[model samples]
Target chain A: MKIITVKKIENAVAQLAREANLFLRKDVLTALKKSYRLEKNKRSKLFLKAIIDNAVYARKEKLAICQDTGLPLVFIELGQDVRILGDFKQAVIKGIALGYRKGNFRESIVSDPLLRGKPVYQGAVIHMDIVKGSKIKITVMPKGFGCENKSQLKMFLPTVGIGEIKKFIIEAVKTAGPDACPPYVVGVGIGGTADYASLLAKKALLKRIKLQRGLSPACPPKQQWREGTVSGLERELLLQINKLNIGPMGLGGKTTALAVNIEAYPTHIAGLPVAVNISCHALRSATAVL
Target chain B: MPYAAQQQYCRDCPSDGKIMKILNAPIQEKYIRELKAGDEVTLSGTIYTVRDQAHKRLIQDIGRGKELPFDTKGAVIYYCGPAKAPKGRVIGSCGPTTSSRMDEFTPLLLKKELKAMIGKGRRSKEVIAAIKKYKAVYFLAPAGCGALISKYIKKAETVAYPDLGPEQILKLEVKGFPLIVGIDSQGGSIYDKD
Candidate 1:
């Protein structure tokens, strides 16, 4: 059995938080650049340029990319054969608090939802999964509220077709319009229970966007999931969403969305649950494994 | 320098033959009246920043008839709550937040002669009506461009509500701050047209 210490986890989470806030992921950057190249609207091109430049400056200056450093969400994949040495939850909360303080990231979390007290950097939304091997992987995504507020969930009758699901996803993006800062990276979760679907949608945002048509990393070499499976659906949705003309900041352009990432799981025979989670251009997350 | 003479030939201006205008804050109504929706402009001089909490506090103060932290007459307010500055920087990544969140408190501030608001996203119809009623303008700073926008902010100091942390009201001196006119004084909106 591999023994993992809480101190190691704490350090990793802290560094990941800081890195995620300061650096725009390369996949997101590549997608943005491609959109800039393809964008026909002059105003949208300018906005895209500014966004790209902002990422550069943020990295150079070691600054938060956007003011809303967001609520820290830590996703953990734990190996069944690994045992943690110390208080795991406390370590994560402490790590996030320490990182936010040291990195000058804005603590966007409030103590209570309704009461809404002063912002605190105490806790993070943690999602953990038990896996096969003896390794611990952590990914920190600081989800900005501007897009997170626009997330939606729908419970569809099991008899419905793909057309209805597509419409619902399209409507969610439309309702988001310019409010959530398009061109968005749209994450869709279909199947599972309601809450699980929401979680799956959020997790879908972490997928690496495929810039070209090829095998996706999520699938095995023999599977060819990119052209034959859900990835085909992703491509179709991407085309439909960009047609909405809700371009960068909803100013109207050809690139309304950079990518559509979908995750699916088995659900009850009588229900079909769908959730949409939208992410802004500065899609920031960092991952580390030990 | 002449107000309109400093035009930089903005590439992002609306396709309506409107020349990019360079204006200073404490903006006059006449200058605002000259702007049309989709016009690209750069602002210089002082502008105040306020976000959700500050808006609520400002409204409460307005309700209680207390003196405001800064003069509101003919002033341009930016809807932003900036990140805390790191060492040696004047301010951190300061950029506009979603403007619609401030809709509830905007009309009362407009009644105090708030000339303009700078933010991202669409505004409520009530706020749009209020903007037209007050002949106020709404400007759009590029969303999600905080670090780039911070370069324009030469100075930033918290002016009120220190307890609110990043949500504190900030008085910022900006130079050549880029913006696009989202809604003009005459009920013209870039959002509607485009």
Candidate 2:
């Protein structure tokens, strides 16, 4: 058995929050660079270039990538053999608040949803899972509302077809239009209960966008998947979304979406729940294992 | 200015061999009329920063006939909320927020002679109509490029509603701020013509 202190977890969360907000993930950055190189529209090209430059500037200057430093979401993979030394929940919430304060990130969480009270940073939405190894992995994703507000979910009949699902996903992006920044990383969650599916979709955004074909030299060769698998669906959906031509910032071009990531789980025979979560080009997340 | 000479005004763009115009803020109605949808331009001058909460307060104040913190006539409003400035910095990452959230209050502000708005996303049909009626313009800053955009903001100072936290209004002095004309005075928009 391995032991981990809550203080260590807290400190790790704090660091992860700052890093996630300040630095664009490597895979995301590479995708943006590739998009910039291939973008045909002059306006789209300029916007992509600005995005790339912004990431670089944010990293070098240690500044938040966007003012909407976002609501901090903590995802933890805890090994079953690892026993924590302190109150895990409090440690995470404290860590998030401390990190936001330390980084000067915006306090975006409103105390009350309907009455609309003061925005505070004392809480975080945390998801924890137990795995086999002794190591603990923590990932922080700063979900900006611009795209989060555009996320959609539909509980389809068990009899529905793949085309219907595809249509629903595309329509979600269409409705998002220029509102949520485009060149989006689309996350699709399939085959779970309604709430669980939404969570899965949100989690899918953390998947690194693997470049296909000649998009990026640094990206490893594309992984192979069976014709009926989730990976194959992801590739097909990506192609269809880019065809929307929403482009960078929705100015209209062939590079509407950078990547589409899907995560699926076995579900009851009664319903098929699919959720789509769109993230802007500033797909920010940081992960560390200890 | 001759078209050729106007094209020479800024060398940072026109990479596609297109003309990129430069506009100074507190922009005149006539100048706004000359801008067409999809025109790439660089903006310079003073603008006010506002977000959802600030807009709510502004509209409420207008309803109560209370004095506004800044002049609305010919003033430019950017839908943005900046991060707290780090040490030795003028301001932290500041970028345009989605404009549609403010669609409810936009027409009234347009009626108040607000000349332009800077934000990402499409405006409502009513807001677009108001733009035509008032001859105002809607510009889009590159979304999610906050760190790069902050470089153009030479100064930022909170002007009102300090208790609103990040959503407080700020007065910003900007130079060479990049923008694309999303909707022009004639009701034409980059999103669609019809």
Candidate 2: C-alpha lDDT = 0.87
Instruction: Give fnat for candidates 1, 2 and onward, in order.
Output: 0.72, 0.83
Q: Alpha carbon lDDT of residue A258, candidate 1?
A: 84
Worst 10 contiguous positions by lDDT, candidate 2 chain A: A215-224
The residue-level lDDT of candidate 2 at A62 comes to 87
- Which residue runs does candidate 2 get wrong by more than 4 Å? A215-227, B1-19
DockQ of 1: 0.60
Supply candidate 2's per-residue lDDT for A279: 92
Output the number of the lDDT-best candidate.
2
Candidate 2, residues A71-129: lDDT per residue as tens digits?
88899999999989989999989889989999988888887789777687887889999
TM-score of chain B of each: 0.92, 0.92
Comparing to the true complex, what docking class would candidate 1 get?
A: medium
Q: Which has the greatest TM-score?
A: 2
C-alpha displacement of B45 in model 1, angstroms? 1.5
